[model samples]
Target: MGKLTDAIKHLIIINVIVFIAPQLLQLDFTNMLALHFPKNEHFGFWQYLTHMFMHGSFAHIAFNMYGLWAFGTPLEQMWGRNKFLFFYFSAGLGAGIIYTLVNYYQFNGIYELFINAGLTDSEVLSILKSGSTNDVRVVNAITQDQFNKITSLFNTPAVGASGAIYGVLVAFGLFFKDAKLALIFFPVPIAAKYFIPVMILGDLFFGMTKYSVGNVAHFAHIGGALIGFLIALYWKKNQFKTN
Candidate 1:
């Protein structure tokens, strides 16, 4: 195997361990590591880093690891391990910040909608805690009563390496702007410079459109790309003076 960046390699190994932990050790640690939005009572400060290693499903881990291997090796070679690691974590953190803010606003909007419909304090609290509308049915005898109280406070947690991957995507586009990469499942080859921006734009459009199958955190992807692009620009400008 070619020499891999320490940080990237470490991250990959951790993700693999976590993904298989439940299957091998019979421990469901994803719930503990996944980053819950700030409104969640269970949220902890460490989740920002831990969540990057947690994946919701096999496809999630596979896709993320594939992207990391595809883009990160070249990035580490170009930027060195430390800088690459910094960029990766920073982008992931930025994604979490953006996702939190957006979720907060959405929660508020939904809260107001429920209040307008005459939901009481207890009722409102219930909806927020459970993360579901009145239309959604509550299951299980134990949670039935607390359903309304918890729903209001309930915020869906985001878990994945997508943010970091997006950072790598941005780096690939910026450094290899003219390099051509072919899309899987499609035979056509497209330049990285063109392909990456198009992907960002498409995410933004669909994110706003609220299209079905658009549950993916498109803004988080955009947030990571934006931060990555800015960091790359700064590095480019300072390269001569620093070196």
Candidate 2:
């Protein structure tokens, strides 16, 4: 295991503080800092950045901070603090943007269905806000599945550093393609080049399908990996290094 680099150390510290401080203080920061749907009342432009520093639970922060420390140490060592910070935030921001875009698409698609079925904007908003519809017309306008999806899209907030850490994993793979890594579920060691792509592919498959196990923001992970791969590939091709 590599020693904690400067950037990764500070990041983990911040994450820990953010995770614990709110609970101790009996304050909730989710509505203010977590990434919410664009149409949601709680959403703000700054959430794209702030949400990276927020985490949902102890296990969530633990897993993400571990990934950051493990995979990001080598990256911060290779690219100086400034460059590493730039890359990390870039990937995180990309993840948020891509995630929002995907949600917007889904929201709009269902919205059009409601509009085509002759529901007014106010009626649609009421249904979303109240999570119920007394009007049979509104009920007939959209299926239960569509209603559930749209409700979840608006109500659920995305919070964590997983996106940034996913980027770190990609960079690690690029820098140490031969490095062997294994997951808890699958303990067999595999080279970074092979493992990272397969992991990302799994995220993509889960993101596109309804078979995902939990409340995973799979698209955010895929977005981070995509941005990280692009940036790392460009740097590799040009032989770029911060130091």
Candidate 3:
């Protein structure tokens, strides 16, 4: 409701710098900043926090920064800068952890199937490392379908602020449940309480069924929302004073 608070401003500045620096400096920050599967060589512990500030495109960062300024400002104002930053990073790290867990679940199934089909761990690791098994010489009859699934899972790296923004969205709904809101996909005005849940449920459905239009990390979104809900629930019960 007021001018961009300190934490929000710093976050936006950092995101902008990180997003642009890659291009200006001709650096491949993705390898270090983007969240990757734990088994991947690119994976690192710092990525859990860094990935929050690394978005995919202009539109991606723009939308997330807008969300940060829009929903996160109110939260920062209420929670103070330190607590807000802690919550923001917590949600983001939690999202990455959950996203990785989900990836493990999905990829493990494929890995196990290949193993049962006579593919060795070394063969699977090679496939994952190469991001493709098409050229790899394997004795197992790796079908095109199976190859595609494994490649997709191994190659898909998540980079965005959507997770923490989703956390802010959850807090917004809890603190301002009656606030009228709408999404670009559905512009009709709706209450924040219902709107947030609908968005989370959509992510859940897509995450569960593996039916998404783009490279949307649905599990990360849901994970952030879940953590945000827990934090908000705790705060609300304790009646954290904003004043």
Error in Å for residue 131 of model 1: 5.4
lDDT of 2 by residue, 1-243 (tens): 477888888988998998899999999999999999987889999999999999988899989988888888888888888889999999999989998999899899998988888888877777787776767776877789988899888889999988888988999999999999999999999999999999999999999999999889999998888898899889989988865
User: What C-alpha root-mean-square deviation, in Å, does candidate 3 show against the real structure?
Assistant: 2.1
For model 1, residues 24-83, the per-residue Cα lDDT tens digits are: 987876557877766566788788888888888898999998888888888787777788
Candidate 3 on 1-243: residue-level lDDT in tens? 669999999999999999999899898888888998887788899999889989889999999999999999988889899889888988888888988888888788777777776778887888677866554344355666666767777877899989889998999999999999997878899999888899899999988775788889999999998898888778888987653
Q: What TM-score do all the candidates reach, one by one?
A: 0.83, 0.97, 0.93
Provide the global lDDT of candidate 1 against the true structure: 0.74
Order the candidates by TM-score, highest first — what do you get? 2, 3, 1
Q: Per-residue error at 15 for model 2, in Å?
A: 0.8
Query: Residue-pair clashes per candidate, as listed?
Result: 18, 0, 0
